[model samples]
Target: MKALALVAALLLGTAAAGRPPEIALTFDDLPSHGPLPPGETRLSVIDGLVAALKAAHVQHVWGFVNGRGLAREAGTAGVLEKWRAASFPLGNHGWNHSDLDKVGAPSFLDEIDFNTPILTGQMAGQDWHWFRFPYLHEGSDPAQRRAVRDGLATRGYRIAGVTMSFGDFMWNDAYARCAASGNDAAIRQLEQTYLTAATEAARASRHAAQGAMGRDIPYILLMHVGAFDARMLPRLLAQYRREGFRFVTLEQAARDPFYAADVDPRLGAAPTLEARLKDAGGKPLEIPSYSEMLGAICR
Candidate 1:
């Protein structure tokens, strides 16, 4: 019986050792995101997120910042300070979370430049050259895209590519609404939907990566620092762990060849999983939408 149990254990270990998926978690809209629920301050949300990350032993999870949040919301700057105090790195999101596709390339470049001083002050001479595009929209036209890319390169900024996300931002507003209404049942439903979206998204992303790249590339999971996100983060991290994902630093994940363009902004724009799959003639995975689910629940 002992020999049989040992063999089973060995087999399970071998299966688990077979190239577990790697992911780097990144949060956008630092300092502030989504509508706050009753009794929960921005500082409280940051505290929750920081505690969860530290408890999970996830290090160097980058938080992309929009500098305007500091001036727009009093005491929001402390959120960034809290993040830094946790020893996590900060990156540029934009000055006002402006979309490059809407604003011209020149204006978008100025926004990036505008964000530099805050990043410099927060990073304190540390490397904070990574930039995550607002709304994940690079540009609407080829010329615009090229100009922004060139400007980012000149600024010594590397683009942060997002390969896995389930539109987590959508849930934040709904969660806030549900919480405000004191609807425990509705909030519970939101929790389930949020995790379900995340789980399905992870699966879809992995399938897409395999179909497009012929293997799993190190993934960058995009998230927001919303109140509900802070609430669900510990469970979310546990879910990823159960799915056999090994957390890695953004820099380490970017070292993969698939992220070469992202690691060096001088290269062409980093190809998204959707783009790669489209180019490979593979069918795109259907991302689950919670819009209707969220719409009816809180309202």
Candidate 2:
């Protein structure tokens, strides 16, 4: 009995010392599917996607549910309550999913205004400080980024950008085309593209720091909350795990200075999300539609 107890204690100690998860799963457009084209078959897909996340124990999700969409699909009261119930972190996508830069500051601020009431009213005075620029375009001008930053400052919003990149769009296309073309075409494409994106992102970040990209940098991976993305979650996680990455949430991953451009640990300016996006060719992926230049995002 004494020998057995000693062995059990050693095993427990080894298990307790295992590394914590390091990858952050950030989902955009909470429950926002593409255009509702008639026969409602996607509702289940959405549910399945959410179920997968829940099953994987993914607690924090950055849901970008537009107010209008909430009223239309998941009813504002119910969606708000459900998200809050899940303890999922919420952020404003925009008023109506419109482009912030094109509309200018007045209209942009209006977008913030449009949702503030709902958040304050339904969530009971919940303050949302994180803002995702529509289409991930901070602004057309450096001043515009500053202006949007100032707007967030006026209302206490945090400007978020992305760190690691992926062809999440292509993941879906591959599945669809593979089904059409037969075989595990989507899976194969996903395997190829997924590895490419991950490797390339690592390379880009390393190059960006001029040779500091390692396991230490907190990586913010961008993923849409679409069915296909959710479907590919397991395999994606496995791939990253093999590459020696652990799963974390946006709040934790965004803490790294590489992803957060200006978080001064001294004076305490929480690092904002700012990273240079690169295409598969290792060139800069332009805004308005990145990683989609090869029609990877669209079917």
Candidate 3:
């Protein structure tokens, strides 16, 4: 089966066959994300993830926390402590994962401000000054986007940008459902769907970079700290390795030219580099959305 999988990957011609690509892994919804299976504890989820990171030698992965999520999830502070204990850097994902579009600029900025103290308390002496916009929505308009950008600057925060994501969170939720139902066939299907999606997203982003900048810039992949991720991270990382991805810290990935885009408060927020590229007239990339992917399985 392993040999068959490899053959399938090669035939698809999407495997990383040459120079290794560089990518940084960043997880949002930290402390906890979604309900765990019947018996899984938050500690086990966090510890398992940290262990995977250690085994992968990923020294600088980033995890963003929603202050409210930390408060809502029982014993999440302990889970966050584990991240700090493992030396991972934490950033603010807002007090709640509020969308800037619906919350309005003023409310959204408040959310950003609201998360600081909790995050600061959790991450002493470590640089916890980065902010990832919840839902990757900066604002609905240029003015609103600039408003948040200015607010972040005033608070001494750099926006953590995501360039590649396979919607792992979507796969995770589906996996949890299948696991609960004891559907092994669905579980197997989910794994294959996930790996295939990851490969395709990587390839599309690489091309998007090429079309936009004439080269492949270091990518920052968005994932979540959830039960399925803990179980699958090793395999996911292995697939990335097979495709020639060298894991780098968020700091290192930021050094890539693509991340150097000046945060122009005058411009509206375009979260992913691909979006920015498309806005600048690059070819449209047909990346799948989580809702779109989930519909295929759920239906």
Candidate 4:
């Protein structure tokens, strides 16, 4: 998909149905530092992100580690330490950021296994049960989903699911350009674009509530701990807070029954945490892709 189109698609998917103090922030690629310090690139995004969370007094964050980078990157260890000390949750993103669905269950699970030790070693006391599927895309298959889950279970990892995400990666990038342009119009345009998406997403959930599900549960806001988020987070959080929404972690939100019970019979993804309720021969309708079955959002 084209970049703008792709960005819009991401915004719509996570916004499908929700409202309120329910939100979770997650970063993909830990230590998203650039080449290294003294080098201009120097994981600027990560540094910004960490500072934003610290200032916000955020207690729990899901850091998706890039195993290889952990060993090579200079500041990666330091970043991990700060997170560990603060007791934020750490998740495995794979030995590298390999796409789980594309890799097939075998290699996919292996990447996860290889990465776990490094993540555990860095994280120490906390549990590394959750995982964020790279690209937020996993192959749409039931068996593969099961394999991924079993692999995690074997190594004490759980598949993490996100219910809400802002295309913050894109949002931040766009804003960054506007700032550089030094144009007043660009700044207004940037804010207008994102604010509209955020509002629409919340509205979508509320509309779904009056029509279908009585209420939308906690919304998991996915963001990368890169150049964009660190700067965007404080503003995003403040914006949401004013909008009357609070923050949450993936663990807290996934624990909700509706989100857990969403089973796509085709690609099981992972078994629903609400297994008992899921049993007794009634599964929610296997709807088509949220993108396909439904028409283009933000079109």
Candidate 5:
């Protein structure tokens, strides 16, 4: 019996070694996701998120800051400091989380420039030069996209791209709504839905990469900082682990060949991988829109 158990363990280890997905964990809207519940403090939410990350043994994660979000909540500026103190890297999410598609190219560039001082102070000389588009909306037109891209290039900023996200932003808000109304049943459903969506999203990302590039490149997963996210993180990390993911830093994820695609400096941007695939004339994986996903919860 003991011999059989030893053989099984060996087989399990070998299987685990066969296919391990690499992903970088990234959070947006640092210091706050939206508004906090009446009694729960932002500090506590940050503490919970930090604790969960530590428990999951995630060494290096990235959090992008919306300077405007920080400014809205008094005494919440320390959230970024806490994230840095906890050893996570910080990036700019624009001053107001403005949409580049709706906002003109010049306005977008100004927002990026505007957030620098705040991020610089929060980073304290650390390398904090990455920028994530507020809504993943690169630009409405090619010229605008190129303009912003060129602007960021001159500013020493690398645009952070997301390859995996379950629209946890929508889930978070729905979860909050349910919680406020004390809808325990819906809250439970939300938790399960969130995890299931994450699992499926991981699969879709792998398929997208394989279909588009014939290989699975390291993926960047986008999430947010919120009370529900803090609560869900420990489980989310475990879910990723079970799905064969090894957490990586944003910098590390960028090292993949997929991230090495040359900038076309063209108009009409898509997801990083999708744009690359489309440029190569390969078929990109199709996933549901955010509104489609949100409708599942709301309806």
Candidate 6:
């Protein structure tokens, strides 16, 4: 009996060690993102995205909105309506997707304020107090960062921190260019490179998390609602599955201690993996850029 108990314990430990990592998917620049391809409308792009998410069983994706898009593009408001109809939550990106480092705190806060009504109406009493910084620029200096952080907290908003991204948005315009010219070969190349980048980024992010925090916390992956992303999401989700990542909600991911500050706005600034790596005197991972190749190929 003692030998059997020991064997069971060892098996359980091994299973626990082999558990997959968790990641939450969040899309920025809702309503519109990047250049639309030749045959795609904004609604069509969103419909495709919603279908892909549903097919992957990814419930509770958060779509961050920039209110200015609704006002600028006719019929774009329906994109948010369709997103809500799918039962996904919406958060504020900003009124105009302004950069805090360039726009200053006062203007940035006003941008947040301008975006509030749209979110309030769209959310309809659901919790919509999450804010994803435009371009992921918190601020240029400590004082500026503090001012914006304080402003967000005062407005009852918690910051959304990004731990993983593969520059998915960069592929959209290139895809559009290729599609316009009916360049099937170039499009195939783009698809291959896109997946390669995403795979490498996942590996690098895991390494960074282990090196910085000494363990893997649940990761929040940043993505954009661009045309190419909608086209490739089915395969991307499959790739993550193959790499042993389980999809989670943003709130669920935030429950990890690494996201404590992000979960509670009143806490101090969240510690990023990059900052942690710098403090530990470790070098950052150098993920290769496909921007030049992406640009030159399709054009």
- Supply candidate 5's per-residue lDDT for 37: 47
**Can you give the TM-score per candidate against the true fold?**
0.93, 0.68, 0.88, 0.70, 0.85, 0.92
Q: Deviation in angstroms for 112 in model 1?
A: 0.7
lDDT agreement with native, every candidate: 0.87, 0.55, 0.77, 0.59, 0.76, 0.86
For model 5, residues 9-122, the per-residue Cα lDDT tens digits are 443353376666689999998878864544667788888899999988997788998888767778888788788899888888898888887789899889888888887887
Scored against the true structure, residue 261 in model 6 reaches a CA lDDT of 81
221-272 in candidate 1: lDDT tens per residue?
9999999999999998987776678899999889989888877777878668
Ranking by TM-score: 1, 6, 3, 5, 4, 2
Residue 159 of model 2, lDDT score: 53
Decide which is better by TM-score, 1 or 2. 1
Candidate 3: minimum summed lDDT over ten consecutive residues — where? Answer: 261-270
Candidate 5 structure, TM-score to reference:
0.85
Residue 275's lDDT in candidate 6? 84
Candidate 4 total steric clashes: 10
The TM-score that candidate 3 achieves is 0.88
- Pairs in clash, predicted candidate 4: 17-205, 18-205, 21-246, 33-43, 34-42, 34-43, 45-226, 45-227, 101-139, 129-158
Best by TM-score: 1
Q: Tell me the TM-score of model 1.
A: 0.93
Give the clash count for model 5: 1
Candidate 5 root-mean-square deviation in Å: 5.6
Candidate 4 overall Cα lDDT vs. reference? 0.59
What lDDT tens digits, residue by residue, belong to model 4 across residues 1-299?
Answer: 24334434443454444444466767777755322212223345556667777787765878887777767765566666666665776888887778766788899888887886777687676677677778777667867767766665566555567655535455554545445545557556555555555555544443333234445567666667655455456776665655556677777877776554222222345433223224534333221122221122211
